[model samples]
Structures are given as C-alpha cells and as structure tokens.
Target: MSTPMWKRVIARILEALLAIVFLAPLVWVIICSFSPQAGSAQSDGWGINNYLTLFNYQAGLPTYLFNSIVVSLIAVVFSVVVCTLAGYSFSRFEYPGRNLGFMVTLSILMVPYASLLIPMMVWFKDIGLNDTLLGVGLVITLFQLPMSTFIMRNAFNAVPKDMEEAAMVDGCNSFQALVKILMPVVKPSMVTVGLLAFLEAWNNFMIPLYLSSSAKSTLPLAMVNMRQQTMGVIDYGATEAGVVILLIPCAILFLVLQKYYVKGFMAGAVKG
Candidate 1:
C-alpha cells in the first residue's frame, strides 16, 4: 500500500509550497520586528532597541509579563491536574450516567465565554476574587477543563486495560498502579494538556481585561494597552517587536511539546 512515486513527489512539492506559504508571513514578521521599517533590517543602526523600548515603556512590561506567567502557570497546573484525574475516572470507571457526564463535561465548549462573562464577573466581584490573578487563573482553568478532560479520558481509555490489571496483580494499589504504570503510558496527553492550557491562559486578553483592573494585567492585556497607546502614534516597528517578544514563549513551548501534542490529540481521536 505504498504511494506511487509520482504521488509521493507531488506530495513533497505540495508540502514544500505549503510550508513556504505558512512560514513566509512569520519570517516577514520576524524581519520587520528587527527592522525600523519594512524591507529594511533596521538600517538606521538598530539593534534590539525596539525590544528595549517596549519593555521600558511607562507601566512597563515586566509586571504584566510576570502576571501572565504566574496566571498561566497556576491555571495550567490546576487544569491539568483536575482534568487528568477526571479523565482517568471517566475512562476507567463505569457508572450510571457516565456517558451523560462526559457529554456535560464537553458541553462547556459550546457555551460562549462572552455569555458567561457578565455572570462570572458578578460572581467573582461578590466573592472578592475580581481584579486578581487568582480569579483570572481560576476562570481560565474552568474553561480549559473540558477539552483537557476529554483528551485525558481518551488517552487513558486507549491504554490497554490489561496493563492496569497486571500492575494490580503485582500487589500495587490502584493509585500506585496509576502513577507508576499508567502515567508514563499517557505522558504525551499530559504534556499536550499542559501546553494547551498554558497557551490559552497566556494568550487570553478578555478574561484578564474583565477580571483585572488598570493596576494589574497579563501580557495579552498589556499588549492591548500598548496598541492603544501607540495607535495615534502608530509605531508598527516597536509594536511588531513587542509581538515577536510575546510570540517567543509560545513558539518555544510548541516546539518543545509538538511531538507529544500531536500524539496526545491523535490518541484521543483514535480512541473516540
């Protein structure tokens, strides 16, 4: 069932073209970020000045970047732990309404975040969680849970039941078996869930904007602030530089976790 040589060549050609098509804009952006203007490599003797200007601007980026990292980490950790545990339960334990429960878990994705914003805002405000990174992180964790849980459940379900039985036969408790035996088998799903959760939390603007005030913000909110401040002035060069800075972490994380990310998603899909 191998492909014909001609088809293989066509696929290689298409892949090369598609790669260029997708990467060209990113390359252009990177080039522009280093340049004071388009089609120039900061010819006016530029070198990371644009980057410095962005971070050093009034109400500078350090605090906001800290906020983003803190929130994203908290959210990612909580989301991954809760969802993975939930997924294990869903995949391994059968009980009444299990199917219905799984559907309900996934139903959140259909519920628009905007629709919940007002209610969530009011609730958080009343609970004294508003205008805080903790609140934002918790809200992010809530949104991330459904898909994370689904991915994890599928990952666990895909693992052979005999493995768990074998581990138990070796006198290991359920928890020990899960941790020592099953976890390694599903490590890819865990990485995928963590990466997705982190990216979502890091890139989120609306949640932070709504839940946080002027005194506090995440990177995404700070980016918006930068846009507004630079709007009339319109310094595309600095803005693009800031964007490149912002993109670095995401790109790095994806590159590191890509192999696992694909495997995790595919494992879930195959199981489903």
Candidate 2:
C-alpha cells in the first residue's frame, strides 16, 4: 500500500531539513573562504580573491595537487581492476575456501585503520615502500578493496548468466564477454566503485602524513600546512580556500555520476 498523505508530507519536510543540516557547514566554509579576515572582529576580508591567491605560491598548491591527483587516479585504477576480478570470481566461480577468502577480505574493514598505522609504517619501511607515492596508492587501494569487491560481487550476481552465454555463442571468450558484453551491464557499479576509490584516496591524510616525505606531500598535507603556517597564527582564509579546493572534485564527481550512483548501483547492491 502507498504511504498515507500526512506521512508523505512529514517525510518530505524531514528530508528537506536533513539536506539543510548537511549543507550548513559547506555553506559556512564557502562564505568564510571569501572572508578577508575570518575569525576576526573586522570581517573586512571577504571577497573572491582568496581563490586567486591559492596558486600564488608556485611550489605549494600545484605540486601537492599533482601528487594528490596522481595518487588518487592510480589508486582508482588498481582498486577497480582488482575488485572487478575478485567480485567476478566470487559471483561466478565455485571453489574451496572461496567464502573464507571473501570473509577474510571483509574482516579488514572490522579493524580500525588508526590502530594499523604503526604496523603499516613498520611494514612499509621494511619493504622499502616508505616515502613513496606508489606505496601510498597501493595501501589506499587495499583499504578500498573490501567495499569495492562487495559492491562488484553484488552487481555481478545481479547480472544474468544468460547474457555471458549468449556472447560466447557469438564466438567471444569469457574475458571478451566480460570486457565487451558484461562490463557494459555493470559499468554503473564500476563508476560507483571508481568514484569512491578516488574520493577516499584523495581525502586521505593520515596515510600520506605517515608515508610521505616533504618532497612528495599531497593536497591534504598542503591543507594542513595552510592551517599551521606560522607558530602562533594560522591563515584561516587560505585554509578555507584549501578546504573548498579539496571538496570541489568530490562534489563534481557525485553530481556527474549521481544518476548511475543513485539508480543502478543501489539496485544491483540490493541483489544477493
């Protein structure tokens, strides 16, 4: 049965309220970014110039931004590839220890990442992976894998086996069927997984903080630098601008992929 009219009205009102509650902080940061002297009594420093000033230091934002971009993009590619393969195996193949392997992978999510920091640092150093972007990206990909695999497995399970069989009848092998036929069917889930992987890698601070050296710091580290520019004083204006810059890519990605994200991904996830 349909929801009652009064309940529907109340739900819509609550939804609108929740949207405002979430947007409030972002709106404040945007406003404060343009503020000339944020956290000051004068309030005289409010304008669009903070954005322009972000790239004023050539070595600062640009280099860090490049590091972040490279790390995130690499992590996305690796995560999506591994997750797709793992998910396909879980969905299509029956093997001994399969369920146990999937369960072990999922168990990674149960442990606190913070708790693993010390061990991760020691392990990376021992393996000569410390102070490298590749190491950072690799660790990020591992962190994202369990969720990505879960999503992809559900997506693949939701797909009809008949389609792959039909493609095989057309002389396509399993890999070809996956690449040419089945992949299109699950592209939405792929986008969701890639977007999530990118966002997580992009926003990751502690990983980079522990693993990175001074020469190869990421954008989030740059934001931290902005926060503590001087010993006693912080530049709130630049920091807010950094926050905006950091947030823009995530917002734009969701806006662009919102259709696939909201529709296909969830429906597939709802399947076994």
For TM-score, the strongest prediction is: 1
Give a tens-digit lDDT track for model 1, residues 164-223.
Answer: 999999999888888999899999999999999998998898898889986678877776
In model 2, how large is the Cα lDDT of residue 44?
74
Model 2 ranges with Cα > 4 A deviation: 1-8, 38-43, 48-58
Q: Write the per-residue lDDT of candidate 2 for residues 8-123, one digit (tens) a residue.
A: 99999999999999999999998888776844322475576666556554466788889999999989999889999899999888999999999999999998787887788899
All candidates' TM-scores?
0.91, 0.90
What ranges in model 1 sit over 4 Å off?
A: 37-45
> lDDT of candidate 1 vs native?
0.84
Separate clash counts for every candidate: 0, 5
Note each model's CA RMSD in angstroms.
2.6, 2.5
> What is candidate 2's local distance difference test score?
0.84
Score each candidate by Cα lDDT: 0.84, 0.84
